[model samples]
Target: MKNSREIIVDILLKVEKEGTYLQLLLKKELDGFESLDKSFITEVATGAMKRQITIDYIINEVSTIKINKMKPFIRNLLRMSVYQLKYLDKIPAHAVIDEAVKLTKKKGYATLTKFVNAVLRNVDRQDIILPDDDLSVKYSIAPWIIDSWSVTYGPVIAEKIANELSANRAKVSARINTLKTTKTDLINFLVNESVIPLPGNIYPDEYLYLNGVNDIASMKSFAEGLFTIQDESAGIVSHVVNPLAGEYILDLCSAPGGKSTHLAQLSQNQANIISTDIFEHKIDLVKKNASRLGAGSICAELYDEKDIDKFVGRFDKVLIDVPCSGLGLLKRKPDINFNRNEYHIAQINATQKSIAKTAASFLKPGGSLVYSTCTLNKTENELMVDYISALGLVPDCTLIDYVPDMFKEFVSGGHVTIFPFVANTDGFFIAKFKK
Candidate 1:
């Protein structure tokens, strides 16, 4: 049987080699492990992936062979080992090196065991220096990402963004389904399950920040759909939409239906909600989440956002939580740190503009539309808001009322970019407009 370290290395290898999402693979690979082992595996695997750039820098500083020249297995193994050595101070360096050697041999790299041992030993003894001038290397973020943030948000905010993303705080936000359970009741359930529930800054009455929730799937309340996992920032978008009872709401590019289902709940299940996504499988996820949450008013459908002629001007409210570069979710989804780049941002921007345009067309002349994204990228957030407003939709400054007083300052001209540090939630953007 593979030990926890081996499992972690396997998980990291797949993430680096195959672009597997670290979170999804962890769920599949961690089954049957003890809680402690599971935690270790998750931390090391995720940390290695998050700090890949920094880890590679450390490796190259100590080793004659650069990380890129090494085999994928060796590259990831060294990265994981370096992460433990540098960040996980609790683990002894000798033990880490010994395990790396053993794992190298086990993986049919017996000839390279001595090389691995020597390189790791050098890393342990070397007083490695990070390039202070290169924020990308210091933060393990790509250069393009660092440059974009620095230019858009300025150096201080950009560095804070990097720091927040690297912190990787473990907190899960759960939104209570008021139609089924009250906040007190859900807190009681979470307490019964040994999960600590803390008050959420945004929508505290309907939201809780959970800790020690190892397996949400095992929680009876979760299976029962008493609440759903959603970032308080995401929950804010639903409120910004402010769906009303008996109104028609169109949620374009909606899948897994977080906002759409929340809209149904906010409307007390009385609104007619059409939630759509291009992929049939993603649409199925919307249907499942809506059904599980008992948001019966949500109608999940497979439809492309680019083609909205059939439903133009037919809805009282329209929500376009368009796909973004996901830079804001770095703390939650660290894989995005390495996977996304400048080209991806440009491609997504066009799609976002198209979706925003189509979403405006979907709204009636007097209807309200909320455009949102879980990203800190200005091109995707502020610039997209500009593009939408240019299409003649008037910015609705009243959106400031829907958010908490603390976030009100971020609101300017009906749009706000919620920094992760400011909100203690995902860095999100919200813009409300009237067609």
Candidate 2:
């Protein structure tokens, strides 16, 4: 019964209130999206989410009513409308106002639609105000996150990271599925399809960068399993492990199975890869990916980190790609910035430490181990590596072995911290070790 924008408003409000991931919510709502307007739906939903805190600041600055006093629906409605007015230059203010007012009327808030219409009509597009004194508010990020980065890396570097995270065109990267196609052939295919394939700095032969193409999943090459949408940082993880053919490998937290399938592809389908996830139902994702990629070496399993004792000394190499506060993915997933907090960091890091320590038992003595996270915090990266090293594993391998030669400096003490700007990819922290 509702249009795309109205659905987005409902989804965004529910995401904020219920702490749901925007990507997952969007996928659930846009299951049969071609019949509807998927592009406009995604643009408004993600644009409003990415500028959420800033939109609220602008609303409170301009509106007579405080945001806290407004109903949740009104607050989200105002946010979506203000976002369109501020960022979407092509969309006229009157169109946004009309759509928002229509939604309000349908919600039986006819009296409030006048107030919404007035607020939208009065916003001066020429002049806007933001938190000038605070970098966090200026970038629409949490102050504590900014403070952490400032203390760890100087203010200038922290601001640069914030600027990139808040406003940057996140590049699309995909690794060629070696099982089905060669990198050269894939590049040729992409070029033939009019999709520019740029060389990736890291994992040179395995990854390619591109832009402007949407619905990668629906691409002919993608359906043919020619490539998988993976960042160079994530693709590098499987390379770091360097699984030899016929070796047994364990991938903890392997839902969606990017790294696991990469391991299978890299090993030429000779390695035995056990892709384990915490939830049984989610293991289906690993199965689906393995099937699409033709990675016959991968076998999906349900095994939570809490049950790590059952898997002790079971593999030649182990990948503890433990979960952490997904701060590294701000550019890729804007909802992460709004939902994550210091408490989440603490809880996730605790689990990370536990998982890495327990997964060590599954690696034979002298076997390789890689502890990785998609986060920028030292507590989750360097500290977790140090904690694992303290637990009887020794840092033995070179960290920069998997990245570009220029990134050798970031590799020190057997771990590499891939900052957003420094790596021009997801902010990931990786440590290589041996039991």
Quote each prediction's TM-score: 0.94, 0.92
Which pairs, if any, clash in model 2? 313-362
Candidate 2 Cα deviation (angstroms), residue 153: 2.3
Pairs in clash, predicted candidate 1: none
Separately for all candidates shown, the number of backbone clashes (residues 3 or more apart, or on different chains) is: 0, 1
Local distance difference test, candidate 2: 0.83
Across 197-306, the per-residue lDDT of candidate 2 in tens digits comes to: 98886777888997657678778898889999898878768878888888999998898899999999999999999999888778998999899999999989998656
* Model number with the top lDDT: 1
lDDT of each: 0.88, 0.83
lDDT of 1 by residue, 1-435 (tens): 899888988988887778888889999999889989998998899888888888888899989898899988888889889999999999999999999999999999999999999999999999999999988889888888888889988999899888778765746899999878999999998899999999987778988999887888888999999999999888889888898888999898798888988999999999999999989999999999998899999888889645667898899999889999888888878899767887899999999998888778888889998999989888898887788889999999989889777788778898988888875788899999998
Q: What's model 1's overall lDDT?
A: 0.88
User: In candidate 2, where is summed lDDT lowest over 10 consecutive residues?
Assistant: 122-131
